[model samples]
Target: MKEGTVLIIGRPNVGKSTFLNNLIGQKVAITSPKPQTTRFPIRAVYKDQRGNIIFVDTPGVFGKAEDLLSRQINKKTLESIQEDIDLVLYMVDHTRRRDFEEAKVLGIVRKIEKPKILVINKIDKTTPSYLAQYKFLEKEFDRVHMISALKGKHIKPLIDDIFKFLPEKKGESEVDFHEKPTPILNIDSKTYVAELIREKLFLLTRDEVPYTVNVEVEEITPRSENLTYVKAKIITTADRYKKMLIGKGGKMIKEIGRLARKELELMSNKKFYLDLEVITDPHWQERIE
Candidate 1:
């Protein structure tokens, strides 16, 4: 059976996370319209009749990393690429024009010596397309796929093509699926829960609010067999941003907590008491190591 590691690389909002989630049939990473929504590399495993594959969904590389967070995210993406990867999937969003950001990501992808695949994502969007600009890339790679990750179009064929490049493993599986309860390997329950809350913050908030905030889960305890108690804090850089996150009469915070709680409950098959609050810490970005 063919088994190996695959790394997905692309610029911000190019649907890298969406593609990984769809391929695995699970939400191992959080995604949003905001650039750099994925702050770190998320490692998850995918298994089928062919073999086991480990997929690393990395943070999108930025053309100009003006902020401390953006710089850190770019560094993380670079670090991920340096690891032992069996294959590389360079994805691009066709709905958006190819520019400096795309060039920056491509410059990095070109340096990888492993087998590479050029995946053109968002094929469903035809009106505002720069598909012609990316067509020239087809000659550079042996395989090119046009897929709509969100719609799951042409994904099966892409998976089949990926296996063709993978090296065969003749022995037992490397990952002990019986011991690992979830496909996600790099994060614990607390970190995953924090990410879920952060996703809500990203989806509900507007403009810079989502970018300026970080979610931290202070404590997660079982109150009873049917319920879990989770206490988390939304850390931001300024009091004004905190006030906006809290909203007038606590409307915004309440809604964010409600949506996060519902998803947590659905995932765990138990009730959750999410004690969420907003706080201001001017140096929160500095602590992002």
Candidate 2:
């Protein structure tokens, strides 16, 4: 079967998952307004009567001097498009300035030797004054098309544009709606870890705690029939933050576990034993090498 992969690379909180959900007409990835909500490269395989396009939604890249995990995320995001990226979709905020930080990410995208599409999201927030300066915005992104992703604007044309760039489908693979073949309707490993942590942080932590937290799966094993155990570490840079995660009488950790376990059981379709631990390991911290 003929296949092609589309890499969605952009900064944090730019609506990558939302954009993808709109494209596939399904909720495969968890969408939250929080930055770094998407931590993994989620693959949504869409097979239509025309062809199949594998969309890889990646973690948002933010250039930070403090969090090591964020640095790793940005590194991994760049690595996604560095290899076999058939198309690179770079999402930019139509309402924001091209600061040095955002420019850094764009620099990485500029290096990708593939067809690049600039998806300018959040145009619904724009005014007539903003529209008057649209041309000025266009100059910042060379050969980029502007569209409001949240309002479902220009998405069809955008998909059409993506299909145009994709290599033709050989028509060998038939659509298996019963089995739901071609389009992958599940979140990947990176996404699962990210969502578990994000949902917890969003609920438990306030202020900077939610922003600084990162979750990684240390181990996953199947113990017996219809049973699986997930060992994951919730990482933070500070010991005080660690205390916060544990909370008063370990209430915080328990809540996080309960929520994650419930979601896992629903996804796994089996009994799940989720063991969650908090770590202050600087390995995935905010600092750069």
Candidate 3:
């Protein structure tokens, strides 16, 4: 059976997270319209009759990582690339122009000696096409595929190609599907819940508030068979940002909690009482390790 690791790399807002989520047929990463929504590399397993594959979804590489958070995120992505990976999927958004940021990511991709595939995403958007600009990469890579990750278009063929390049496993599989509790590796239940809250903050907040904020799930208790109680906090850089998140009479925070709770219930098929609060932490970004 074919089995190996495939790493997905791209620039910010190119739909790398979306592609990973769709490819796994589940949400192991959080996504947003905002760039750098994915803070770190997420490892998830994908299994089928052919083989078991480990997929690493990495944070987008920034052209200029000015802030502490952006620099850390960029560092994490570059570090993931240095690991032992069997194949690489260099994903790009054809609707966007190929500029210096694209060049920055491309430069990294060019250094990799392993098998690579150029995946041009967002083919569903026809007008305002920058398709011609990325056409030159076709000759550079042996395989290229145009897909719309959001619409699940042409994904099957992409999977077929990915399997073709994977190395065959000679003995018993390292991962036993029946014994594995979850496909996602590298994160616990609390971290997953925290990410859900963070995603809501990204969707509901404006400007720099989303980037400045981080979520922490402190306590998760099962009060009953059908209900789970969760306590969480949102850490921000300043009081003004905290106020903005709280909004007038706490309208904004309430909306964020309501939306997050709805999604939690939908995914877990149980009730969740999320105790969410926002606080000011001037050095929150610096604390990231």
Highest lDDT scorer: 1
Alpha-carbon TM-score of each model against the true structure? 0.97, 0.73, 0.97
Q: Which residue runs does candidate 1 get wrong by more than 4 Å?
A: 170-172
Question: Clash pairs of candidate 3?
Answer: none
Give the per-residue lDDT digits (tens) of candidate 1, residues 141-224.
Answer: 869999999999999989998898889985876777888765856988889999999999999999888989999999999999
Per-residue lDDT over 1-289 for candidate 3, one digit per residue giving the tens place of the 0 to 100 score: 8898999999988888898888887788999999899998998888788887788889999888898999999999999999989899999999899999999999999999999999999999997789988988888786999999999999989889999999998587766767766574678989999999999999999888898999999999999999999999999999999999999999999999999999999988999999999999999899887
How displaced is residue 26 in candidate 1, in Å? 1.6
Cα deviation at 159, candidate 1, in Å, is: 0.5
* Candidate 1 collision pairs: none
Question: Higher-lDDT candidate among 1 and 3?
Answer: 1
Instruction: For candidate 3, report its TM-score.
Output: 0.97
Candidate with better TM-score, 2 vs 3: 3
Model 2 lDDT tens row, 33-99: 6777665577787766667788888988886735556667776776777667678788877576666
